[model samples]
Target: MKPAGSLALLALLLAGCSAGSGLTTGALLGDDKPAAPVNDAPARAFQVGTASARAVKCGFNFDPAKLKTNYLAYEKQQPSGQDTAKIERIYDVSFNGVAKAVAGEGEYCSETKTKTIKADLGRHLAGDYTPRVVPKEQEEGLFSGMGSGGSAPEYKAKHPMDNSD
Candidate 1:
């Protein structure tokens, strides 16, 4: 459970890495879907930052201050001589309710997993870091044997003589 490996990691990413305001607000407001390494850097950065913040806020003992500063990304309009309005993401940072330190409850991760997540998140927060592309094989390993090729192992074990194809 390295948070950086295996099936669970894929799930975390597929969940839209839902944590930051920049995750969807700008695109939703501007009617433009920003692609990675192109225009979504801010949104991507915010998502990772928010996750670190959440881990710290949730008491996973993640980092420096154990706090998360929420940020909002908004699309602003400016007067221009061009036909189309200029679109950009404006950021707003917040630091309220940080002293409360709400302790996380239930299913705490081991220190190893916590550290792994912290490191992974940190790498993602960097400016020039592109995400590590997980190979298709690794991603499919967990579910590769599910409902395919034959019946469940238990079913075959129960019907010992029923080997007819």
Candidate 2:
């Protein structure tokens, strides 16, 4: 059997290493949890500035006139107030992601469909730009599909079955 004295010394050494304090004094004291690592995405005061503009255009098929009018309505109706550009960017990002996921489906979106996509997209962006609840109900028809009915858009016409000749 090994000496009991060696086992006690080994335990002390292990405890000191695990405690993570290089100083001898610290080994007698408890250790603190490591700091949470920083995320790479910068937290901007006006967050989503980069993504907002593109999102609005891509998600909503509104022209300057229409987009302005819809924004005005959002300002009037939404209690949280509007940061028109910021909200737009968030929607634009959401739309692009969803469109890409659906394989460029935004190209054929309708007014209602665009709004629906905006709502779904808004939810995702809300977490991204916290303390700012971007309105989900900006009524500009941004994309090109009707909310309910339409065939998936095709890039070119397919050959008819009759071509089997």
Candidate 3:
């Protein structure tokens, strides 16, 4: 009984040590969330850019002309007392990130990728982005044919009777 209890205590201590052994203070505390971006002007701008980049990576389409228009709209909607330079800096960083992400996707011609990404980022910044949602009918249809001849191509093609030879 004593040996069993000692082994259990040792196991618990080892587990605790392993769990607390992360190099960062946050990791030691078991907190995995990223620290909030700094409040300084440049840092805030970078955060805004990072957020915009992430949005593009998540599938928002690019449209530059619309983005410019949206930026103008956003600028006009800002309170009259806010600092213009700070706002511009944030916008600049955001647009740069957006461009980088869009161009990285390789979905468009090289010449037009930058333009498309810029537009897409602009659309996102203007609050125009929305994730594509499958309609209920379509979702139902997808599962309706499951396990039947009309299911996925791979499964249907692999069915024994599907071979012409």
Candidate 4:
């Protein structure tokens, strides 16, 4: 009778051969430069765990479509970058409107809310991707004054304000 260890080795060889039949035994002996990438987005760095922390840096560019709306009222208020203070004031008002909407006050309604997020989003995008205006002292101080350690506000609406601004 065949020895137990020899039988197990034979079974393992059969399994490897059957599983990898598509790979020619000869190709393993060749010296080839690696295969070229398939398309624009790379595949090597995109494993499951690593992908969560990785982002496709704005590698591709896009054009502004006609559908895109101009939400920054501050742009109309001051097109030229000459007046940072006035632009910042308009931004503050728009941000306050956003905060009120987020607070469930709905001071800025559906249409106004859309305009508000857009405006703030624009200012944030334009100012080196940072918020152009800091919120007022009252808004800044609201968090420390809150009863809790400022967990999520007690309530939320379809649109919430960045009360911290």
Candidate 1: Cα lDDT at 144: 41
Instruction: For each candidate in turn, give its C-alpha RMSD to the true structure in angstroms.
Output: 16.0, 24.5, 19.7, 26.2
Model 3 off-target regions past 4 Å?
A: 1-28, 33-62, 75-80, 97-165
Query: Model 1, residue 165: what's the lDDT?
Result: 13
Better of 3 and 4 by lDDT: 3
The stretch of ten residues in a row with the least summed lDDT in candidate 3 is 156-165
Off by over 4 Å in 2: 1-72, 104-165
lDDT (0-100) at residue 47 of candidate 3?
34
Q: What's the distance in Å from true for residue 85, model 1? A: 16
lDDT values for all models = 0.32, 0.35, 0.42, 0.29
**Which of the two candidates, 1 or 4, achieves a greater lDDT against the reference?**
1
Better of 1 and 3 by TM-score: 3
Pairs of residues at least 3 apart in sequence or in different chains that clash in candidate 1: none
Query: With candidate 3 superimposed using the best TM-score fit, by how many Å does residue 77's alpha carbon deviate from the native?
Result: 3.2
Global local distance difference test of model 3: 0.42
User: Over all chains combined, what TM-score does candidate 3 have?
Assistant: 0.29
Model 1 lDDT tens row, 28-52:
4653333232224333333344344
Query: Across residues 1-165, which tens digit of lDDT does each residue of candidate 2 receive?
Result: 133543343334334323234344432453332222222122221123222333454554434334434433444455555464544533333333333334444453555545544553363344433222232232123232344354643212211100000
Q: How accurate is candidate 4 locally (lDDT)?
A: 0.29
Task: Kindly list the per-residue Cα lDDT of model 3 for residues 1-165, writing each as its tens digit.
Answer: 254553454344324323233357774685535433233333333334443554455455654445545554555564544465655545554545345534555543333434444454564565644312222222233234465665453321111101011
lDDT (10s digit) by residue, model 4, range 1-165: 234543343334324323234344443664233322221111111111011111111111222221111223323344344344333333333323333334444342345334434554343334312222322321334344456545654322111123332
Q: Give the Cα RMSD of candidate 4.
A: 26.2
